[model samples]
Target: MLDAVLLILREVLEAALILSLLLALSQKLHLQFRWSLIAVTIGTIGSWLLAHYAYEIADAMDGTGQELLNAALYSVVILSVIALGLFICPLAFKSHLENNLTQKKIFASPSGKKLIYRLCIVIVSFSLAREASEIWIYLSAFTHDTEMLSSALIGSAIGAGIGMSLGASTYYAFTFMQKSYFIPVFLAIITLLAGGLSMQIAKQLMQIGWLDSATPLWDSTFLVDEHSWVGELLYALIGYDSRPAPIQGIFYLLTITPVVSACAWHAWQLRVKTHE
Candidate 1:
């Protein structure tokens, strides 16, 4: 039961965090949650399909198919996250500068709103599909063992409840922040989240022998136990690993640099426009 809880919690927490972030962004943009509903439905079906075909998928690409597929999904997720940050920062900053919750002039266009809506949907759908597929696969493995199956199911429920509750708390915390701080906070979290995902891609590539592995860059487990609740939260928020490989750090930096640079440039442009 404990093993099941931890496994399910990790997967559920990841999806929950991503969904909560994107949903919070949607609210900030004055968008409806209709896209969220569609995304959830698509994600549920996708997870079932992926889990149903797991063996075939694992068999493909000379037994490296699963890693390759996961890498592809992670890449898509990272790119989508970067795109969201790049697109939303300016609008959010504009709203902040105007000192309004709704940027009427900026939010006037249906196209802009639709684009953001679609991005959020894509992020949530792909993220949920990837993360929840693991849970589905785990639960399916114990189907023949009724005794263990019941325990796994109960553990999964508890894990999912805890994960969702944490995610909701995060969303509400964001809602309570002042507008001036929200833009930076949102962008920082988005950037770090994308970097963490890129680390996942690096791990997948390494597992498939596509990328060279290296020694651990550093170990912070002495300061914070990786299995603790705080560690789990950090992992969900930023892909925190106590002893990440050097390649993971490299991937993290590579992903973060461009996002930071782009956001800085966007902020600069916004400042210049405000002055003009």
Candidate 2:
């Protein structure tokens, strides 16, 4: 239940952040409100469709095929999280490119009437791919459990609602009170989540034997059951495993520490640039 909630929350939060950035950019650029709304609507629909399809595909697989599918899905999730850590985390601190692109599309359109449609499709496709990919991974993780599936979906809806509300509030606060003040904090949180997700993916993949070199660096199985509250909380937030294999531990540290350090450096650079 907790894992389901965390997965949904993280994915929904990321989507909300992306959409909010796009919407805020549109307002900043003085773009048409209708066009922005259309874009967001299309993006949301596309993401939903893609997520449905991914769930269907997972549902169809069984036996060894299901295991293989799960393994592949997790591997993709890990890589995607790593990519976000390396690229998107830094980009979030910078100006909004989606808004810039929308502005360009609007200006370049021969007929202003068609600009909204074109912009909507483009933005929808872009955001949908990222959002759906994350959703697919989360769904794949719990494909075998009907109760967990329902719980995750409910959690995702709730998380999305919370995220949308927060996003709206953030936009208002930034626009009215302190311009760009929240970007650093937002970037930091995203970086940490991405790092943690990547670590979790690595650990999961190692468990499935998709990766080589397995030996526990330290076994804390005696300390706590993984399903216990303390264990589960650490697992959800920090990707902590009490009995992690040596290679898993190494991969976790290797993937998380550098990404975090890099994000910190990026945040510092953004701060300096803002001041200058």
Poorly placed runs, candidate 1 (over 4 Å): 92-106, 270-276
- The numbered model that scores best in lDDT is 1
Each candidate's TM vs. the true structure? 0.91, 0.44
lDDT of 2 by residue, 149-222 (tens): 88887877776666567667756655553324443444454445445555555665655566664666777867
| Cα lDDT, model 2, residue 183 | 36
lDDT (10s digit) by residue, model 1, range 1-276: 887888888888888877887777667656787998999999899888888999999999999989999888888888888887877666555654464534555467787677778878888888888888999999999999999999999999999988899889988887777656776788898899999889989999999889888888889998876788778778877988888888999999989987788877877887898799
Clashing pairs in 1: none
Q: How many residue pairs clash (N, CA or C atoms closer than 3 angstroms) in each of the candidate models, in the order given?
A: 0, 1
TM-score of 1: 0.91
Q: Against the true structure, what is every candidate's RMSD? A: 2.3, 8.5
User: What lDDT score goes with residue 53 in model 1?
Assistant: 90
